[model samples]
Target: MMGRTVLVTGGSSGIGRAVAARFAADGADVVITGRRVDTVAPAAEALGVRGLACDATSPGQVAALAGELGGSLDVLVNAAGGLPAAPAAGTPPLEALAQEWLSSVSGNVLTAVLTTTAVRDRLAPGGAVISVGSIGAERRGGSYGAAKAALAAWNVSLAAALGPQDVTCNVISSGYVAGTGFFGDGMTEERHRALVEETLLKRPGTPDDIAQTILFLASPGARHITGQTIHVNGGAFTTR
Candidate 1:
């Protein structure tokens, strides 16, 4: 990623922050975006990168961000996604479930769609689009998993559209990445043990694990790789 300008959404924290740092360490001109202006600016400055305050779910904000960068983007990492704090409740029997599902869709799927659409035209030739996915989508869970499944499906079309431009699009389906907000408050000892037990490596993943994969996907080494979901789950699940 040397000399490349990479943009990581939701870079204020978690996997996004790690991705931004990895690219910056590789000498890329890194730019990170988050809804929190204060958090993003300081983190970017500390990491010797630029910061932009843009909500990935908002098309206008994403467009303005692209304009600020002079409309030339080399890499776009869609890492902004999570479940809502509380499910939306309603009078109808299934209204809460419906609202919760919508919230997940808005957060995980729509956010990536809006950001990708706004910058698709400005993406440089040979650009790469990497979205952070979750193993939750494959596990028994709620709307969050469903949304991630949608994201993976959407990336397929994106890859096809950008293939001719030499822009590869892919998703990294991560698993048990520790030190993230996926556990909400935090991971307890028992929960951590269970997660590790389920993995072949008998350990939890880290942000750097996903970051390294993103770096590979963005590099010339992975030029031929596109329209695929690469699992980074330590053999938690495998395809025949």
Candidate 2:
């Protein structure tokens, strides 16, 4: 990855931050974007990376991000997404459903689609795209799972479109990532235990687990792999 340029969205925290740092440590010129400049800027500086304040859901911001780091992109990681605030207890079924579904789709599917479309041309040959996905899509994922499922579908079309350019696209479906703010304040000890129990490994996943997979996909070792979703779930979910 020496001298290569990579971009990771949502680099202010969690898996995004870990992935950005990992890439920077590998000698790649890393660029990170997030909605909050204050948090993301400090993070970028700490890692000796460039920080861009861009909302992945905004087309204009995405275009600007592409232009700013355009023409030399070797990898793009769409890690800027998550569930919004949960609905109030006892809220109407329609109202609660609407909010979660919208938030999930906007944060997950739309963000990746807009970012990928904005930078498709700037992506270099041998480049790769790695989007953060979820194991939720397999269970009763609700709106979040629905959005993640859509992301996988989009990846197939993206891979086909970019195949001619030698830019492979794939999704990394993560499960039970520990040390991340994925659950916000609702992750209770009992819930945590239940999550661990669901996994075959009987342990939670770390950001490094997902980051290493991203690195592998971007490396020459995975040059032929594309249009597929790789699971990093610690055996929480399996496909026979």
Best model per lDDT: 2
TM-score of candidate 2 against the unseen true structure: 0.95
**Model 1 agreement with the true structure over 117-236: per-residue lDDT tens digits:** 888888899899999888888987478988899999999999999998889999999988988876786678998898889889988899999999999999999989999999998888
Q: Please write out the lDDT profile of model 2 over residues 124-234, one tens digit for every residue.
A: 999999999999888878888989999999999999999999999999999999999888987999999999999999999999899999999999999999999999998
Estimate the TM-score of every prediction.
0.94, 0.95
Per TM-score, the best of the predicted structures is 2
User: Where does model 2 exceed 4 Å of error?
Assistant: 87-93
Clashing pairs in 1: none
The regions of model 1 sitting more than 4 angstroms off are 88-93
Whole-model Cα lDDT per candidate?
Answer: 0.88, 0.92
- As a whole number from 0 to 100, the lDDT of residue 204 in candidate 2 is 95
- Alpha-carbon RMSD, each predicted model: 1.7, 1.6
Q: In model 1, where is the ten-residue run with the lowest total lDDT?
A: 84-93
